[model samples]
Target: MKARIYVTLKEGVLDPAGKAVVGGVHALGYSEVSEVRIGKFFEMELKDSSDGERIREMCGQLLANPVIEDFRIELGNS
Candidate 1:
């Protein structure tokens, strides 16, 4: 199975990198870019494990930090 994990900062968190990207976009004349948020994408391949709960636990424990960010995992047959 293949899992795609998206990690992103929660609301109210100040993202300097996102701000920098926004500033650069504006400098390049993309004034229409009002907001930008940066996030991470992780693609993982795992063995065939029927335990869905364990997979979720893996996401919470190793794949994502629960304090400042949130993660969504999409699992599919590879």
Candidate 2:
């Protein structure tokens, strides 16, 4: 089985990287942009059955910062 994880900053958290990307996009003459929120993406192969609890534990433990980040998991067939 395959699994994917997405980590992103919480709603109230500040994202400097996202802001920088927005500026860069507008500088290149694409001024129609509105906003961007930067986040993390991960692809992994899992040997066990797709378990939500275990996956959530992994996210909380190391995949994301619980203090300021949120995560979502996507599971797929191998």
Candidate 3:
């Protein structure tokens, strides 16, 4: 099986990198972009152990920092 993990900053957390991107976009004349939020995407292959519950646990334990970020897992066919 395959798993895709997305990790992002929490709502109240400050994202300097995202802010920088937004500024850069604006500077490049893309004014339509009102905001930007940067995050991480990880793709991995797993064996039979790749269950939803286990993937969620992995996100909470290692893929993300629960205190300042949130994560979502997408499962894919083997």
List of clashing residue pairs for candidate 1: none
User: For residues 1-78, what per-residue lDDT tens digits would candidate 3 score against the true structure?
Assistant: 899889999998988988999999999999999888999999988895657897789889998999999988889874
Predictions: Cα RMSD each:
1.3, 1.3, 1.3
- Which stretches of candidate 1 lie above 4 Å from their native place? none
Reference-based lDDT, each prediction: 0.87, 0.89, 0.88
lDDT, candidate 2, 1-78, per-residue tens = 888889999998989899999999999998998899999999988877668678779889999999999999888885
lDDT of 2 at 38: 96
Could you tally the backbone clashes for each prediction?
Answer: 0, 0, 0
List where candidate 2 sits over 4 angstroms from the true fold: 48-50
Residue 47, candidate 2: Cα error in Å is 0.6
In angstroms, the error of model 3 at 49 is 4.7
